[model samples]
Target chain A: MLVQFYNVSKVYPKGKALDDISLKIDRGEFVFLMGPSGAGKSTIIKMMFREEEPTRGQIFIAERSLVRMKRSDVPRVRRGMGIVFQDFKLLERKTVYENVAFAMEVVSAPHREIKARVPEVLRMVGLEDKENSFPGELSGGEQQRVGIARALANQPLLLIADEPTGNLDIDTSLEILDLLIDINRKGTTIIMATHDRELVKAARKRVILLDKGKVAADYAPGEYLVC
Target chain B: MLKNIWYFCREAVKSMARNHLLSLATISTVAICILILGMAVLATLNASHLITRLESDLEIMSYLDKDLTADQASEVKQALEAIPGVESVRFVSREEALQYLQDSFGEDRYNLEETMGKNPLPDGYEIKALDPHQVPVIAQQVEQVAGIERVNYGKEMVNNLFLATKWVRVLSMAFIVLLSLGAIFLIATTIRLAIFSRRKEIYLMKLIGSTDWFVRWPFFIEGILLGTAGSLIAILLLAVGYETLIGSIQSVPFVPVLSNRALLIEVYAGLVMVGALLGVLGTYISLNRFLDV
Candidate 1:
């Protein structure tokens, strides 16, 4: 298994966001987490990214204790995984090419490596023709494609998408889901959190249902249902 | 590190140029302050040189009575030499004194023989002091000597010159202090204004996981460039100003000796350091408040 959550519970001052949650997904597994509002779906992905930590117990990605890692080491943990957010988080002023190239630059990858790798990533996202375009000039779907290109630029072993299609229509949403599936087929482990039951049923992938924090059901090739 | 500094400088220069009014204000403030300080330094140097020159040149003149017997005149000369601060006392014989007057006035056509019914001059001791300020005290003591008719120590003129020198020092020091403060404040505010304007970029850089050094380099480099360029300008102006205005004084030798060339360079060097330091310090201060937020 590449991830393990050992009796982990995350509580905010307001209330418990995650209550004694425990689950493990192995390497190269494509899993979907389906949950209702305030069910800790975002919290789970945040914990996995080391953006937030559980209140008790422990969590590990690649068998490294993310709960115990120093704040400065968060980048190193992130270096191993690619994450996509709902908002795209793209630098609006920068060109599409520079936006994708930024991730490699942060890791101190040599100039030639960035130059060679950026175009390849842009090509994979099918935005090769729009590499010179800015994010403001692109549609939501196209901007999300740039975000995916940025996330996957460093070839992270794991790709986590948090509500990736939360802001898109049914047609555009499925297009994004297909891109995530395509990225998974290329050998990257994928963990996606979403509330789109119709899409989950259509995709037929492994699904974990969270009801009020704990995992209510874990099913292989399952539908997105809490019960 | 070199590459980072170069990149940092390039961005800083570009931004400063884009914000032309701000760069001009910073440079102007630095120049005005430095110009004032440069003038103060030059004036102070001149006044000090003059005081020392006057101190070395002052002498005690002990005039003898024209009716003094030969022995009485000799006694006065010997007594004047014994006074403290008297380095040497030369006896000016009546005939020698008369001949000196003729030589000095010959060109002026002043007939000394017609001015006096007789050779009305008398022998006296022209006494030199180690310092001019001591001339008055020595003159007072010389007044008590027998056979000495009067003393011509030029006390009144010397006292007025000393007072003028003191006033110059007081005024210049005040000017330099005021100007330095003006420069510090100007540079600090210039940097603050610049940093305040681009605070959005800084916030984004921080959230993007850029380290403190990565964020600080641009502001640090901007300060240095402003200081260097402004000071360099001041130095060039000072160099030209000195050559045009002060060069004549140097050749005249009668003008108090001042190290014009050196002070001009010091003004530039001082401004450069001061300007840069103020820029960096001001940026650091502003960043502390802004970054912590």
Candidate 2:
């Protein structure tokens, strides 16, 4: 197991966001967190990366307890995984090449390695030709590809995408899903949160359905469609 | 590490150019504050220098009894020199004293010499003390010496001058400290504004696992650049103004101003160092809030 959540719960002043939620994910597995808005899907994804802490439970990523980790160690943990956002957070002024290279630069990668890896990752995302284009000049799908390239720059072992296709159209969304599936086949664990049932059905992967801050069902491929 | 620093510097310069108006405002504020501070320091330095010159010029004049012979006068000079605080003593004979008076009379010297036929001036010793503050005590000791009839050193005037110079030093020090605080505050606000404009980028950087120092380096470099630039401008202005003032006052008598090139260079160097320090302090203050991620 790569991630394990034991009886995790979160409480806000309004009410509980996650109640007694326990789940596990294995290495190289592609899991879908299916839930409607306000169903605590984002909260679970946040907890995996240690962005949000559970009110009462233990969270282990690769056997290290996130709840007991030091503040200084948070960045080291985050570097082991990549996060994709809904809006495609790319610096508008930077070219596609620079946007991706900035990630490695921040981690103090060697100059030669950065020069070699940036174009390779951009090419992996099929954006090698758009390297010189700024975000403002690219379409929404191209920008999202840039975001993915930047996330993959560090070659993390796991990728947590929260509504990564929420802003894209149906065709573009499918193309992104295909790209993610290709990445997952290359042995990176993937957890994507979304409310689109059609997208989940298309992936035909393991699905964990959440409702009212609790787990409603956990189904394997084809089992969710049958039910 | 060198590459990272180079990247940080490039980012800093780019951000500064992007926010040129705010950067200009911050630089001007720093320049004005430092200019006033430099002026206050120069005033204090020059005032103290003048006071020192005046004190060094002070001498105790002790009159000898008219009945003392030349041999006895030389003995009195030796006695004054033996005093603990006395640096040196010079004997003024009656003839030299008369000659001094004649020179003071200038064109009327003949009339003064003919009006007083006999040489009635008394012999005296001019006494210099090692420490100006000890002049009063030395004068008292000299008055007690035998054959010394009286001593005069303008005690009240010296005391008043010392008091005035003390106030000048204290006030200027206070002014410089307050101005430094103001400069730091301004730089802090400027850096805070810069941080605000790039807050989203900072958030993304943190989310991507950038270390706190990585996120902080660009802003730190920006603050340092702002501070160094402001101080350099102020120093240039100050140097030009001081040279002009010195030129205008060269012919003025009894005013001891600072004109040494090496000392001015030292003061300028000190100002630049202080400006850079203020920049670092301001950056630290502003960046503390955003680095928690």
Error of 2 at B267 (Å): 1.5
Each candidate structure's TM-score, on Cα atoms with residue i matched to residue i, is 0.61, 0.87
The local lDDT score (0 to 100) that residue B193 gets in candidate 1 is: 87
lDDT of 2 by residue, B40-76 (tens): 7788788888888888988998999988988888888
Stretch of 10 with least lDDT, candidate 1 chain B: B203-212
RMSD in Å for all candidates: 7.7, 3.4
Off by over 4 Å in 1: A1-26, A30-75, A81-83, A160-163, A191-227, B1-211, B230-259, B285-293
User: What iRMS does model 2 reach?
Assistant: 1.2
i-RMSD values for every candidate model = 4.4, 1.2
Of candidate 2 chain B, the 10-residue stretch with the lowest lDDT total is B105-114
Clashing pairs in 2: none
